[model samples]
Target: MVTQRSSRVRLEWGPIGADRIVEPDCLAVVVDVLSFTTALTVAVQVGAEVYPYAWDRQDLGTYAAARDAHHAVGRYEAQRSDSLTSVSLSPRSLAVSSGLKRLVLPSPNGSTISFRLRDSGATVVGVSLRNRAAVAAWLDAALEDDPARVLALVAAGERWDDGSLRPAVEDLWGCGALLAGLRDRGADVLREASPEAHVALAAYDAVADDLEAGLVACDSGQELVRAGFRDDVVDAAQLDVSAVVPVLSGERFVDARRPLGE
Candidate 1:
């Protein structure tokens, strides 16, 4: 009889904690709902190339200077992004230049968190609602080599002054839900395990009429609104939207066609 393989699914919430647990051989899924991840989905679909860099502005500047042309994409309140092109920019702009040699991306949380995990031994893949099903399928196939434990890190925003996390509920819900779905291969497992799936499901249930409200209430959902990327939010939130897995290959992220035919 063929032996059955049993894999334990580990669920992690915060960026730091998730980063600490990542191993080189494992698969790393980084989620930053409040825009970065959402924007990434849009950029890729729009045919824009994405180069992720560590949040060090000096390094980013150096990278950009080497490139031909680029644009910055990010939130304003961040620090050290004034000189770069940014969106939702304030104190420092989160920058992503188009066609630039370097993409100086600095999010309050996503970039640093990505760097930490990327530094680890594990294989890193960028996942958001848009590519959730693709990620799951990739994990299933990668596990064939027993590459390593697969880890999903939700780059949820920081905590509130009360020490309670703002946006915690949605991301935590999403991550846990993802774990639940991955653990089982059944069709229902897909919907059962995803927090992103649940949020959308609930919204559909409550306001089958007002999709905008349901997405806005979620932190990551709201970030998409602020960035004027509603189409991306709805698209990413779909299950199995793409048959291919979007992975980090050297500098830019590429869509690796599906490993197995569905």
Candidate 2:
């Protein structure tokens, strides 16, 4: 209970934080700016039904096959191949993939957290730097609809080589982007935002002038760059470009612009 940051809005890092903060009355927003959620936003923008999967799931391809969806590949895997059979967790890949109606996206960070949070009794929403403003607007409308609903912004930080949480700054910035945008949407929401949420808002204010630069200089960005995926970082650095609010309905993330049933 103490770790839940009991307030109208809260900000926390990693999967453990996600478990602590979310409940049936909470709107859990998962932010993975380096790729997962960014890719998710792009997929949803193109009207694709996205299924989030565990990062360690060995049956990702099998799952996608059963559902007749494209199993998202790693950027390196997609880049190394000439096959047009699938897209990756890179926003650029999903952005260019035509007729992408269904996708089973997996990741070490965002997808893992998202998959686990599906039955957590909270309304899970996906966000990244690209669609923070649109999601904030959606959140404002959501607040109006259910005055009792609370917010939990979870930063799905990366993992170290040993598979431990690395607390990536890119995700922190992504969470901050959403925090500041939501605060700008309404005054009431700010009143009960946790202190940790304010800390994230402060970070957002610091990077507001140069989000692209922030992403370009972060450790995750450098790693992705060395791996030949700098374009993915740039794709996620954009702000408010997408109005697609990815809401978790059943096991898939459907764009909030359309009905969840669709």
Candidate 3:
């Protein structure tokens, strides 16, 4: 329990960290700022249900067809699509995609984390820079109803060349953004935060003012920008612009404030 960072809010990196932090009474918040969770946020905000796919399979098209959902392609593929319906892991690709009812977004970090946590007996939530404040507010109300619940904030950092966790700074900033919002609600939660969680919050506060510039300067951000998808990085840098909170229901995600099937 001590290694678990026994606080109302805990912080860790990647899917392995997710496995360690999640509990039946925990809200497992997945933060993947580069694209996955950002895309999920935009999709859910526009009333689309997102299904996380491992994205490492060759049968991606068949997989999407089986689920009756459109499979998101790569960002470069999305950009060349004849229509905006060509969804991808990029949040910018989801712009003007309101008619899309369902999307199978695949990612190595965020999607994998979500997939691993689906059966962990913890409530899973999708978090990004786009909806951090909304999620934090939503959490405040949800936790109020269940006093025993804690927050397991997982930053789905990128992987290194050796397939080890890269611990991307943007993901840490994203988690810190949520933590900053959560801690603002009261002194108790702020005090209950683990030192690691506090580190994340401090990370966010340090560069919240120039987040866009900060993102553009980061390794992951530069990768996307150099690929001619700078728009994706720019779109993701916007903070707390979305009010929609995506909660994983079954295998897909839906808006938390909206009743299921509504």
In candidate 3, position 191 carries an lDDT of 69
Model 2: how far residue 192 lies from native, Å: 0.9
Ranking by TM-score: 2, 3, 1
Clashing pairs in 3: none
Q: How does candidate 1 score on lDDT?
A: 0.49
**Cα RMSD, model 3:** 1.7
* lDDT for each residue of candidate 2 in 1-262, tens digit (9 for 90 to 100): 5364558888888898888788776899999998899999999998799999998678888998999988888878888899865588878888888898888999999999999999988889999988999998988888888877888989999998898888888888888888788778764787888888888888888988999998999899998999989888888898999998999998899988896555
Better of 2 and 3 by lDDT: 2
Question: What's the CA error at residue 132 for candidate 3, in Å?
Answer: 1.0
Candidate 3 lDDT over 65-142, as tens digits, reads 988888888877767788756778878768777578888888999998897888888889999998988998999888
- Clash pairs, model 2 backbone: none
At residue 127, give the lDDT of candidate 2: 97
In order of appearance, the predictions have TM-scores of 0.64, 0.96, 0.94
What's the C-alpha lDDT at position 95 in model 2?
88
Comparing 1 and 2 by lDDT, which wins?
Answer: 2
Give the better candidate number (1 or 3) by TM-score: 3
Identify the candidate with maximal TM-score. Answer: 2
